[model samples]
Target: MTDKTLRSVTIERTGAGHFTATNARGGEIRFGTSSDPDGGADFTPVELLLAAIGGCTAADVDVATGRHSEPTGFTVTVTGDKISDELGNRMTDLAVTFSVAFPDGELGDRARAILPRAVKTSHDRLCTVSRTVEIGTPVTATVADA
Candidate 1:
């Protein structure tokens, strides 16, 4: 991966009721004011941050499983709850949970030995987004058979 940094983004009104957001490199995102008229048109940056964690975790799972010869596929779901300050204002803390699903077949001992390390390495060392969120949020993961 290159040492690319997402420095800044720009948002502009593009239509009668919509707006477009663009990054420094010309990457654009479109949104509308329908959701929260006061809050603004696109998804909040916090929402995008959650998405980044989920996407990175899923991708790491795929690669880790393949590297381990598991050669399987899985689905991941991430959920978060936010805590606010005394004034009933903005979020002060966030708790993030992840659920990972694997195939139904039982691999017994083999899976038991490798799965934990795969997940640990991904969250503890590899995934950039997970590392980023771990800075301010409490992140946890649960693995299940599907």
Candidate 2:
């Protein structure tokens, strides 16, 4: 078993403007700064950030509500404005909107009723990604060998 206190991924340069990040479990995602003849279908770092924010909460809400009933239509849209200011380059006005619908009747009613709370719980206390952004943190960067 691995330590649950820490989670990490290793990123390596595949070529110019493109890179691959691999988690400890070996899940890999390729991304690049831009889509040129070389970029392929890879996602940009900003998109990944948005995904992480939305994904973390989406997972929490899904598990919370899914226990009661499955959603007929479920989608989470995360939007933000990337700006360069005193904070340097960062996303602002972040929003995670969930468009979820459940079937008719009690099972659906139960899920629907809890959806708002589930989303609120995630935003307030559960989602690590969003929480980190909201609370803020300092990131130190250095060359490992240095």
Candidate 3:
């Protein structure tokens, strides 16, 4: 078996119930406690899961595209289904929709073919959030032709 150490992140309240989350790598994100019945002002823990997956997917696409001759900006849309009961809510399934736009007459069909591969690589290997969810949650993706 391989040995792995748990990574740590620290969260501190910067103001009245508002906070900042800091990772071991020094990356920080803002978070707030909720008071609104509309569920605004707070970054619900569940939302972070989606953001984690989406962000990783986007980064994966970008990195993979960069290795190719024609790299372009990419967008990813993710929708998730959650289960709720007296216990709480948990994600049940997730769908990631990718919309990739390349410059007209870009790098021809080759780049297009490679794009899909990159996205797959991210989900298969690079995206921690996606893989974590995949163990218990269903994950799906659809590629858009540019």
Candidate 4:
């Protein structure tokens, strides 16, 4: 097994409900909840979570199929259902649908055959975001003095 490395992002509140998350590499992503009046400018955290899953898998599939034939068209739609119980609100189910079109002829057939495997590999082992959600990764929170 490869050695495990720590990955982290720092999130800072920019406004009442808006925040900015910065990765170790200094890349930043803005996020907010629907309750925020300015939330329309950026994706909400929940939406970002869904995007992470879809984007990860899409990238993997694209690379996998590139070996056989480039896809003429590619799109992914990810949807999640939210449920509220006495405990709190959480996502109940998520669905990811991929629409891909390959070039006509034998190359297209080859790409089609590889699509399932690509998706399987991504969901089962390659996508860190989806795998973490699927396996229930533990998250610990603590507050530090400013």
Candidate 5:
């Protein structure tokens, strides 16, 4: 039996450094290795990774805080340094920063009060993407046999 918790996406190459990922629900996203978003208009693998990290935690934090009060503004920024070393190319010094604003009132005050704790909870355990990266999960690559 397949694991109930298993989630996956199928990636198909469309061209050099370009690909499409289709999820089980048939949602598709196009991405490429191009560094210029304005020129190529595609997200690089590293950028995708950063987006995943931020998006995951953002979802978690949103669920926790939105129930209390909707924010006037919310943003999450994920940043990292890419370096090639003896360990090969990888990201380091990763950081996630949140800029949020709530209205002036009791509900907003409550949301502001819990914002820090909500972010902490997401980073500590709620965000699977960030948690997996933090835990250094192994990735296995294989080619299909003809």
Candidate 6:
């Protein structure tokens, strides 16, 4: 038997190219189409995807480094390139850059030393979002008549 945790989200159209997505926990987010005819005031799907990946890895790195020293500041920038193929447009290469600051001293030294390993650990296994993307998890869709 396999241990599995089920997660689900529901999305409903709000307006032209605008939608609201709600999770089982009752959390909700609004999003819109990325292209012209501008959808809504919220993040687009691709932007949200980048945020998820960045946020996941950032959390993992923060916790790992916290054992040595709590970072005084931290920020992550994620970027990707859109490419075209027979399948249409999709993000091709993605990059994540983390900027972290620590208190100056031995603690800072230790934190710096641990940074690379922490990032590697997150990308290799810890971050659920990035790992899912890297592994190409299968997604199945079903349609029901209304």
Name the top TM-score candidate: 5
On lDDT, who's better, 3 or 6? 6
Q: How many collisions per candidate?
A: 0, 0, 0, 0, 0, 0
Report how far off residue 37 is in candidate 4 (Å).
Answer: 9.0
lDDT, candidate 2, equals 0.93
Better of 2 and 4 by TM-score: 2
Instruction: Report lDDT per candidate.
Output: 0.62, 0.93, 0.74, 0.89, 0.94, 0.90
Best by lDDT: 5
Give candidate 1 misplaced runs (Cα > 4 Å).
Answer: 1-27, 31-44, 68-73, 86-113, 136-146
Q: What is the TM-score of each predicted model, taking all chains together?
A: 0.54, 0.93, 0.71, 0.88, 0.95, 0.88
CA error at residue 16 for candidate 2, angstroms: 1.0
Off by over 4 Å in 4: 1-4, 35-39
lDDT of 1 at 69: 48
Alpha-carbon runs more than 4 Å astray in model 5:
none
Tens digits of per-residue lDDT, candidate 5, 1-146, equal 37798899999999988999999999998999889656588888899999999999999999989998999999999999999999999999999999999999999999999999999999998899999999999999888894
lDDT of candidate 6 over 1-146, digit per residue (tens): 23367777999999887899999889999998865545435888998999999999999999988989989999999999878899898897899999999998998889989999999999999999999999999878888995
What's the candidate order when arranged by decreasing lDDT?
5, 2, 6, 4, 3, 1
Residue pairs with backbone overlap in model 4:
none
Residue 59 error, candidate 4, Å:
1.6
Q: Tens digits of per-residue lDDT for model 2 on 85-120?
A: 986988899999999999999999999999999999
RMSD of each: 11.0, 2.2, 10.2, 2.5, 1.3, 2.4
Residue pairs with clashing backbones, model 5: none
lDDT of 4: 0.89
Query: What TM-score does prediction 2 earn?
Result: 0.93
